[model samples]
Target: MDVAAIVTAILARQAVRDPATLRPGMRLDDLGIDSLGRVEVVFAIEEQFDLSVPFNANTPDAGGFDLTSVGSVIAAVEALLGEGRG
Candidate 1:
């Protein structure tokens, strides 16, 4: 369940090409992701990571979660897991 694999699953779930590379700063819009696509990605991530991530379109920071990029999503997942350990 490393970041790269998570990223790959996300892209696969979204039906997007696994690009040659990815990183934290890449914006979702830059990847051609729309609102619905982002929701699908969230579901895929929930299934893959077995975590319920809360998001609010009206309040972007409600869950302090940021899925703007593969790396950011990975970071959020990692942070959640870390919190569970505490």
Candidate 2:
């Protein structure tokens, strides 16, 4: 699966208010994703890719996964796939 496309799909599914507002450089908050939505997004990614994502929903800054922007999620997934995790 394409990294950006997968991430974007998950984001669109989890977004609370505006899925169409999703963009590569857009921040998660600006895209209408709340904390619960962030966790759901990660879970969906893990399920879709069949790979574990290093994420800490309660303390996101402590994790390796990037939940900052759509681009960041795409980048992190690309890195993981490069490592043969997906």
Candidate 3:
């Protein structure tokens, strides 16, 4: 699966924005994704990839997974997938 495409799709659905306009550098908050939206994103990602994401809605930073930007999310998911293979 294309990580960037999937991540962007999930974010676009949550933010109600155009997927074409969602760039890797764009922050989740800039897209109007609040805590609830973020949780939804995490859930979608987990379901789509069939892998668990280390995310905590209350303390997002506490988890090692990076949720700072669209690119970071793609990278994190890629990393998690790579780990599963090893």
Judging by lDDT against the true structure, name the best candidate: 3
Q: How high a TM-score does candidate 2 get?
A: 0.85
82: Cα error in model 3, Å:
0.7
Over 4 Å off, model 3: none
TM-score of 3: 0.93
Off by over 4 Å in 1: none
Clashes of each: 0, 0, 0
* Ten contiguous residues minimizing lDDT sum, candidate 2: 13-22
Report the Cα lDDT for candidate 3: 0.89
For candidate 3, lDDT tens digit of each residue in 3-66?
Answer: 8898889989888988999999999889898888888888999999999998987789998888
Clashing pairs in 3: none
Angstrom error of the Cα, residue 52, model 1: value is 0.8
Error of 3 at 17 (Å): 1.1
List runs of model 2 lying over 4 Å from the truth.
Answer: 16-21
TM-score to native of every candidate shown: 0.78, 0.85, 0.93
- Per residue, candidate 1 scores C-alpha lDDT tens digits across 7-83 of 65685457476555555677777777777787888787778778777876666567788867767777887888777
RMSD to truth, every model: 2.1, 2.2, 0.9
As a TM-score, model 1 comes out at 0.78
- The number of the candidate with the highest TM-score is 3
lDDT for 70 in candidate 1 is 69
